[model samples]
Target: MTPSAIILIVLGLAAIGYVLGRQRALKTAQREGVKLHSLSGYHGQSVALFIAVPALFLLAAWLFLQPVLIESSVSGRIPQSAIPEGGARSLVMFDVRRIAEGLNQIVAGGDVSENDLADMRADVTDVRARLAEVGVALGSDVSPIVLQTAKEYRATDLTASFVRNIAVLVVALGFGAWALARIRPGLRARNISETFIKALLMGSSLVAILTTVGIVGSLLFESISFFNMYPAKEFFLSTTWNPQFRGGSELGILPLLWGTLYVSFVALALAVPLGLMIAIYLAEYAGSRLRSYAKPAIEVLAGIPTIVYGLFALITVGPFLRDWIAQPLGLGSSSSSVMTAGLVMGIMLIPFISSLSDDIINSVPQAMRDGSYGLGATKSETIKQVILPAALPGIVGAFLLAASRAIGETMIVVMGAGASAQLDLNPFEAMTTITVKIVSQLTGDTEFASPETLVAFALGLTLFVFTLGLNILALYIVRKYREQYE
Candidate 1:
């Protein structure tokens, strides 16, 4: 049975349990002529939770574990010779799994009978061609041994799926019947239901925490592997950014880091002041009608995708900067440069800063403004001295968020700033950031074992650490000044 079908069946059982449990509780209360410990709805909810939660948990665990067990069993049968030179066993298993899925598709399509599929050999039949007929394209021709292993894998997976469906249904039905039987006037059904809900909420929070840990853990492990193959000192300290797939590449990160900072610095310098001023006007001076229309109009830029901004940079802004400013001043000739990307990204960041700062400024108490006014300060002075200081922490937060967005931006950098990693100080010169290099390094056919590909993870880890540091600094600034303001 399919997972969706199993879920539907479990839900049906839970619904039935709820109805029966509620009826039983009501009947018991009427017959005994006593007040029920919990309401009929709570009894129903308790029954539903008992029926659904454990069964769903079991189903999720089974689905996750089945692949690991099946792969372990099937991959053991694959000989070392079957793994191509310079290829890992995992890649071979990947092909085996794909072949298995393709075979299943063929059987489901009714082009091939199960008996015939079991008897067929890779040598006797064009397995790849058959799979292709069902829209499963293989990278290479399948070997006989690999084909046999895939068949076994399919058989094992089907059996496991069948068992999983049966086990889940049985658990759901058994628990549901047990809960229904326990329904009575004295049962603390509300307590049980509430406890289960609390547990579910806690589980959701843990899932989020674990997900973050998993991402960081994966990056750290791969980065360690990359550092083992490449010198850490050269990667961190040297001022070159070149990667040769053939070998002996100078994978220094300094140039990429410099470009990232330079572009982000330009973007933030453009965005922060304009955005803050816009926010101040909207929050402090603009009439209601003007604020309503203008705020949304300005915010529409935030809704625009970064790729669209990149295209705008490439087609419009880049050329204009090159021809009007760079050519006239003899700065540089290239359309794709750090200045082009930074200006476009800065434009993209405007709405983010303005909207956030506007909200933060408006959140300041009106009494503070009144107090400043009563103290004989003018409107502008009150805003500058009272409102702005009160809103500074949140404004700093908005700036940090915008800075992070600018740093991580890829499409704008790719289209506006050409992918030439260098440490040039000129904004008109073509340059690239770590994000662009990470994408380039991982693009196309890649071997994860090589330093060239693994370097992407190292770059990712470095970016993560840099962003973390920014967050920490923002927190420190907020805490240090927040007391004085309060």
Candidate 2:
């Protein structure tokens, strides 16, 4: 049977099994004079999953193994003169499959050009005739034992998939029907389902924990390597930013730390006020018509790709700042300065702050707002004093999230921030960031053993630690503040 037919049969059988299972379960419950174990849909779903999951798993396993097993068997049949070594065997197998599929299409189809039709007709006829000739020739030229083994290998594979499909249908339907018939009042179906679901949930949770461990392990190893070359004190305390390419590289952490802080501060400086005002206007002041139209419009900012923001910083904001603000203020020579990337990144984060703050503000109970009004507070006064404080911790969380985003932002910094690792305080002057250095040191013909490449890992570790600390702090603040409100 074809693959598509197998799939349809499996699905159709599973669906029928589900319906029958649910009906049988309900009838058994009535006959036994006991309450149904679960909702009708859950009964149906339990049976459907029981039928479908094992069958699908079997099908998937067969599909994955079929290709590898077939390739190995086919590779053995091809003469040694055709190819040597397994290095090119995989590629040749792919081409052979395509050639066989193309021939099948030629034999099956009729609407072809006169020239192409003639060629395809000849090709299919020749292949079929050659295949038959090869079968007969193999029996004679090859040793009987070898010929028998080869034919058995090919024939077994041909029926293997068909057998698997049949097995899938029989096992799934038989087990699902038997299980459904056992679903009486005291069977603990819900408990069993919940246990399965809990396992799934636990499996998902492990992924997050494993990811964190991997990051920490990578950083811990690289930082240990870095400390072997540079002392821990200098890396943490030195103010200078220069890391020498040759022997003079001073691996200090202070300069990059300063740049990270400065850029994060600048982003917050731009994002906070605008985002807060937008939130306030949307939540407290805007009419229903305007609110309906405006919220998604603001959310559109979030969907603009970060690469677009990088280009905006490089091509638009960088040049404008250079031509407008930097020239007028006599700040620096380059337009792509600390401020350019920060400002662009700030724009990118506005949606994040506004949407989160808006949710928190809106979540402030209506009773609180009514109480403030009853006390004679104006609309703005209620929001400023009562609602704002109530939502402060959540807003602070949003701020920390935005700050983390700014600190970790890559494309904008790589394109817009200057590469000079400077300690200068001027926001208009050219400056480089930790992320930019990470990208630079790790890319472009890097040697894994060299300090230059290893330093990127160290920098990455620092960034991870910094972000983790911020998230922990945010959670603490939110928890403490939530207690007061509760």
Q: How does residue 164 of candidate 2 score in lDDT?
A: 77
Q: TM-scores across all candidates?
A: 0.94, 0.66
Report the C-alpha displacement of residue 228, candidate 2, in angstroms. Answer: 3.9
Clashes within 3 Å, all models in order: 0, 1
Tell me the TM-score of model 2: 0.66
On residues 1-486, what C-alpha lDDT tens digit does candidate 1 reach at each position?
A: 789999998998889888988999999999999999999999999999999999999999999999999999889999988889988889999989999999999888887899999998999999999898888899999999899989999999999999999999899988898999988899999999999999999999999999999999999999999999999999999898888868888999999999999899999999999999999999999999999999999999999999999999999999999999999999999999999999999999999899989998987888999999999999899989999988998899889988888888899999999999999989999999999989998993656678999999999999989888787876776566456546
Reference-based lDDT, each prediction: 0.92, 0.75
Clashing pairs in 1: none
Q: Which residues of candidate 1, in runs, are more than 4 Å off?
A: 84-88, 110-113, 444-446, 472-486
Please give the lDDT score for candidate 1: 0.92
Which window of 10 residues has the lowest lDDT sum in candidate 2? 136-145
- lDDT tens digits, residue span 208-284, model 2: 99888987998899878977767778778887766555656676777777777887788889999899889999999
